[model samples]
Target: MAAFDALPGAVRDGAVIVHFGSPLIEQRRLAAGEAVVPLTDRTLIEVAGEDRLTWLDSITSQSVARLRAGDSTELLVLDPQGRVEHAAAVFEDGASVWLIADEADAEKLAVWLQRMVFRSRVTVTVRSDAALAGFFAGGAAEARLTPSAPNGTPLIWRDPWHEVQPGGHQYAAVEGHPASDYAWSVAVVDDPAALTAPFAGALAAEALRIAAWRPRWSNEVDERTIPHESDWIRSAVHLSKGCYRGQETVAKVHNLGHPPRRLAALLLDGSDVVMPAQGDIVLAGDAEVGHVTSIAMHYEDGPIALAMLSRRAPVTELIVRTHEGVDIAAAQQVIVPADAGATAGVPRLTRLSRRPVAEDPRNAR
Candidate 1:
């Protein structure tokens, strides 16, 4: 509780400072250890009513109808033309569901869903005032935790990583009250203020995500972006789920054919590097094949990025050229789609060769 008193108002507004529950400062890579980051841009929406799950499943990429209370799913909602309009972490309680995303998209997504509810007996309310306190731990953790959001999203008390110890690795996203004196988590953490004092601009938090290889919705997804092209097939898609918007295209491209372009991890050359802004051209020798989506100077990996490139681009190291025509070091590594099997030992920075990416037929031309 004492921690909240020391934090700057910025972090207090959108997030709470919690402990790593262990002495993580001793680790060589502090970024890989626990740390606090601001979460001002994100929002939470509440969908309450008898028809919550069934109604949501009709529009989202995942089949929500099967989620038991306390269960959550990563979801994507596509526009009529098949472009992603909203990406969220959805969790269901007994009587409601919560959709968490950036504030700019929460109300719009909820409103869009509400309008589509003719007689489904559903009620969607945008909870723009709600904020999140989250940690992405990567070690061993218990499967069960308390529910914090109105939709009852879990409040994980242990590490989430499977191999890490009880306090090892876990990713927990919980709803918190406003930073006013009534804050909820202050009782548990000491020096909340000091911990949150460092979060200012979104850049610091973005840096953490970049180091974590987390692909953000704003910088990575859009109308022209296909699900597979953003690696949405990995964490966000549920292939076995029944129909939803854009399901046809998703299933066809994933199971029957390779996506025209594949997402890849780009290690930007940072020595004389010009950060490749979104839409900048990526090249292999003289051939223009792909474009950079999101990038940041990594604390450990130098400059790293996510991009979508022509799958036919010779699997080779290349340069990312800015719109201003500056050459930036761009190494390509395929973002294997969900249908691609046996990814156990794939290289993270694979060369873009003509060779089949894997033995899987999904990678076949």
Candidate 2:
């Protein structure tokens, strides 16, 4: 077994791994014929009933009506006003459907769903204890990527790099299937201690994820944010789907107007010091441009951060203003903006950008 000795203890406990390299490796080997990794900081919500898919599709931003027993979709729950309430990986089996969401908000989402079950035949429950894991590295590894819990189940994951790059890599949750849409086979290990025991000298995967510009649910989303503001519609929002709670706002802002805020990746120069704390103000000149969502010290790229800022802020270069009012030099990489219009055939204008944007962490290209 190829133990992940380079992984950190926190990650081994229940976190994802983000391995950086000078050049992306095409192949990696794993022990037990399964490359197991912990899906940390996430929770799973179970919805069981005959109308599980119907109930979800009516409330979320995706077309769950089309999802079969062995399929999954990236789903986003919106506030009545169209702001992001929560995001999840919605998967279905013959018997039930599972929603994988942020650990911090899984219970909240589950409760909300239960409240909405006024007359539906659906039942909602929190299954965060049900572990989620995956693995993939080289080509044609999809067949080997399977969830350990159930055999022959369909897996669904947000295609981390859908807009910036297509088919670069595939992410999905598996239940019963022998394999998934990844380069390596993966499984959910009940033994967190044993599973993470072999990894050595690795930092928290959250740091790598922050550097990658991947927007996690808890770290990146909140009530103040809309799906478009977070660039979530790219992977989570199914624009063409039928009416959901926040569909009107999503459609209007996306098609005829623009979102108030945009998500950016900041390049911080920390050669002189450590990175600033989260919620620090970012400035352009004297203008309060935005606030940092996540920050990290990259192994190769130095200091970097993800932020949601006003649309008028500098798209090329910006500055991070510390609480003490000291300004640090930084460059902005606009990953997901409200202005990017919808894409064709994919069912939404979430990807309608005026020009090519920078590389997003989810899809490093």
Candidate 3:
């Protein structure tokens, strides 16, 4: 609270404050290009030395070997079986690569990166002094408040969720994807004090993200989560990239099979003025099908959530069982369909015809 005490009104959630007193109002202003938010829980990792990009590209999900200075993209470190381990927003300056990740995962990601630096000239260091802030409506203009990179461009990561990147593919089969409207970016600074503008809170930012159908590593991911399940291939995974740790699994699932589960966007019934908490059981009539991964109240959409449901679960109306034993009606918008994969378009063998009548009669005669 001390860090935000200077602000006129605020609300706290756990150790980090979630929003200012007027989150809906702040959300409106943020969408209107009038506000920015200091993402207090985001941290930075710096990778230096000439081998940084090549070394990173050899291990992660994205192809960063040719990532030019001032270019921005995100990468994922998947386990040997292709389960998501770590995700980061990545960019490079002339001398170093900067990774923006959840604060709770920064040190862990840094340690893993350091362990993989065998014989390579790369050096990994977590920059505790730096912080990340986000802006949506005027992200490019707001990014100007931060320090510039060697190329004279603001050190900002333009989010790639709005469109699929070079080696990426979209799993959402919708004609016009809702994520096309997600205009978001983040800027890193040595100190939050450099951002002199009044800011909104994390809640406001989260609401917008949910509405845009964007998935966060912290909220949407679980121990067994794979990129295919979250529709994350739209931004994180590179289908044509060369061998990485989990490349085999990624290739097989995307080309030959469907993910066991899929992500869904939910419109929650807000008649009771109650919201479902994370991990709330999502039910299809009397049977449990999945669990809510994230929920928020949007300025435009009254209440919305993102859930990872079994791919076999019917894509019809559902209900969310709150922690308090209350049932909240939920209408779903399919993000990833049950038949999401099989992108390779392999043909099936035809069955032989069973017309044996003429042949049998001739043989008998």
Candidate 4:
């Protein structure tokens, strides 16, 4: 609150101030590489040991065994049934593997990683002293701000969502993915107070993410979320990685089946000037089909949202009902189509015996 109050014209969203007034202008500045955002909502966890990389490799969805120092990647911890439990942006210095995640899940994720350490040489520690900042421009701001990380490498995690990673597949079959323009990166700084420059706020960042159709663990994931449903396979989950907790469901759904739900981008009707809240019901012809997961008013796209709808939901036309019961018409842009899976195309086995035996006639008689 103190940090936000210091800003001249900030507006509060829950505990965090979402913008320093003029969110649309802030977003424009950010896209033009003229701004940076202090990511107060993120926290960092450090995993250190000779066995850190290998130990993490055995657990998470991404293949981390070969992660080189200064390289950036992300990982997802899934339940045995393949539902997303935790997500982190990962990078490593020569000594420690850093996991940056939502502040709400930082301690919980640290505790969980510690519990799984067992006899491994790995030690999990939360680095509460450190803070994270995001810049769509690059690390040029580091030249002016406080030094990042102890090693002087900035400990930056470059986003890989702009393109398909090795051993990964994209479920969104569009000719060009909107995420191609999402050039984003975050730096781990030793001091948050050193970041005194005017920075774009969370709302500005979120609008760009929504416009890109990118999936954020905080917004796009639910208790039952699998990578396929949100089209997260483009970066987070390694398709050919060795056995992990949820590999079975991940493989099964990707190779032979489709996710129960698919993500869609919705362009909302702007006549009401009302934006639907998260969990607002999404309807098709008066029947409820899904609910909005994230909503934002983009600088150029106007009001837009990302929704997870049942595979059977109609693709073209949709409607969202606001908390006031006013129905806002929406047009659906498919992110994950109904027939998104079955990529492996495993050949179906032919019937061994086409002719039926003169079945149990003797027994019937």
Candidate 5:
């Protein structure tokens, strides 16, 4: 981060590079696969030993036990109530399984993983020495550039949001989602200075992610967020997988009912020149329905954001009230459709059936 931050025209937010003073240009370069962004806000964890993949499979939501080397996927750790706890990109390199998670979640997740390893032949360690560089390589030649492998395989985790995996489900009702073609991946390196590609900042990278309707851990998840609400089940969850901590709730909510809330993308009104901040109140007329989660300025899409709206929130325009008292008119787009879940074709009984039917002696005659 220090080396990348020292680059010319680099403007930073904390340890992260926001942009090289020309976000629009940097966004263009990044979208075209001509630039790589240093991911200072991400951290790596290595789970090594013979039981690594099987242990991970037994705990997480993804079907990872049989993952072949060089395979990439994502998984979510859920609380007992099916709320999201931790999310990460998973890659198998034969020697170990690398989990690239957000900086805010890495430490806690690693600690939890350690505690869960009572007799399992696995060692979970934080790879604090490794740094990540993100690139948008959609099967391009630029994607071939990779760092040296530490365990007989390149440490690159390609994102799996382009399409739903086996045993996964999508909630977005559209025929084609913008993220269906999104190609983003991260390369692990020991030093940030080792990358020679043109640099984009975290801001540019975030804008592209938001534009693709991607749900990230730090931005989209909250204490009560379930995978179904953000449509995370599309990639991070295996619907047909064996039992795990939150499997009951995951199965129930997806097959029997809808999530209490759904994720929505918004196109904000740029007339105010002030963007709504995270946690800002979103409204349907006078009723508060949701709060803004992630906001960004896209090169082509203008101002955009993602929010968690209540199931009661109608499918119409919404109002985003900023801290400065500016009411930004936002047009809402559905990421998770209203009819997302209850997919299982089971014969559901109604409450009326639970009531005792009246009996008459004359009926017996």
Candidate 6:
């Protein structure tokens, strides 16, 4: 921890780094694999026991019953209504399952895991001793990094957002996904001080993520958020996975219905310098269509943000209503298309047309 704080021009909020010096410079270096960011906002949990894999598979939104050691995947915990509640990166080490989630969700997810261990052999424990460091683990940088092998299996939860996993399906069908080239990953480390590379911060990490159209839980989720809305099914939710808490809604929405909302990216007009913030309203003319979930200033893309929009929202240019009651022009980039669902193509029974009878003279009198 002291090693990061001791770096030149380091700025921090509590234990997390805001930026080392320049967020843009750090972003460039981080993207090129010259830097790593200490992920203090992320926490870890260990689920130990012989029944861990099957137990997790029965409850979460991923197919993890046969998860092999050293392999990486993510899962989502959903409410009965199928709204996203918790999400985690999963890694098994033969002896136990390791879960990495945001600090905001770790404690609750740990407790829920423990409570769900009725007859199962699983025992859940939050690993206060572990932490994360994120970087683009591509090329030589992946080789130089040494991930923790505490149980004789290195724990590196690689990001699978670049492509759809085996049991997963993608609702996002862009011509060229920005995330296709994103090789972002996080390594479970014994200590943040062990790293020797130049460090970036959360700001830089987030900018690159927003530019890539990545839907991170902390920013993208609300009480009403479903896996389909933010296109989270691309990585987190398994379409054909066996029964889980919210599997019914998951199957229903995918096969017969369209997701009520979709995720979109807004490239705000940088001319006015009014940076719209999270929770600001997105307006299609005068009606509100969506609200911003995350925002960032990319090195090459200028100002950008991710928003959860109504499925019927305008596909054209919109206006961002800032917190100060100012409106700024924004160009929309669709992440999840409006027609993103009903993959089953089930035929709908058409309604019969009703004949309009002539108005009664008695009603007019």
Who wins the lDDT comparison? 5
Q: Compared with the true structure, what per-residue lDDT tens digits does model 1 show for residues 213-289?
A: 44567777755776666555545666767778887777666555656666677877788745778888888899888
Task: Name every residue pair that clashes in candidate 3.
Answer: none
Model 5 RMSD in Å is 2.5
Candidate 4: minimum summed lDDT over ten consecutive residues — where?
A: 1-10
- Please list the C-alpha lDDT of all candidates, in the order they appear: 0.56, 0.61, 0.85, 0.85, 0.88, 0.87
Model 3 accuracy (lDDT, Cα): 0.85
- Model 4 RMSD, rounded to 1 decimal: 3.4
Per-candidate TM equals 0.69, 0.72, 0.92, 0.92, 0.94, 0.92
Candidate 1 Cα outliers beyond 4 Å, as residue runs: 1-33, 138-201, 211-213, 337-365
**Winning candidate number (TM-score):** 5
Model 6 regions more than 4 Å off? 1-8, 139-144, 347-365
Error of 5 at 290 (Å): 0.2
Off by over 4 Å in 5: 3-6, 138-144, 348-365
Better of 2 and 5 by TM-score: 5
What stretches of model 3 exceed 4 Å from their correct place?
A: 1-8, 137-144, 148-153, 347-365
Which parts of model 4 have CA positions greater than 4 angstroms off? 1-9, 139-143, 352-365
Question: 1-365 in candidate 4: lDDT tens per residue?
Answer: 23334555657777465887789998887777666677767788999999999999999999989888788889999999999999999997778899988878788889889999999999999986666777774434545455476654558888888899887899888887898978888877665665665678899989998998888888888898999998888899999989999999999999999999999999999989677999999999978899999999899989999998999998769999999898999999999999988878577676857534555476554
**Considering TM-score, where higher is better, how would the candidates rank from best to worst?**
5, 4, 6, 3, 2, 1
Model 4 scores a C-alpha lDDT of 0.85
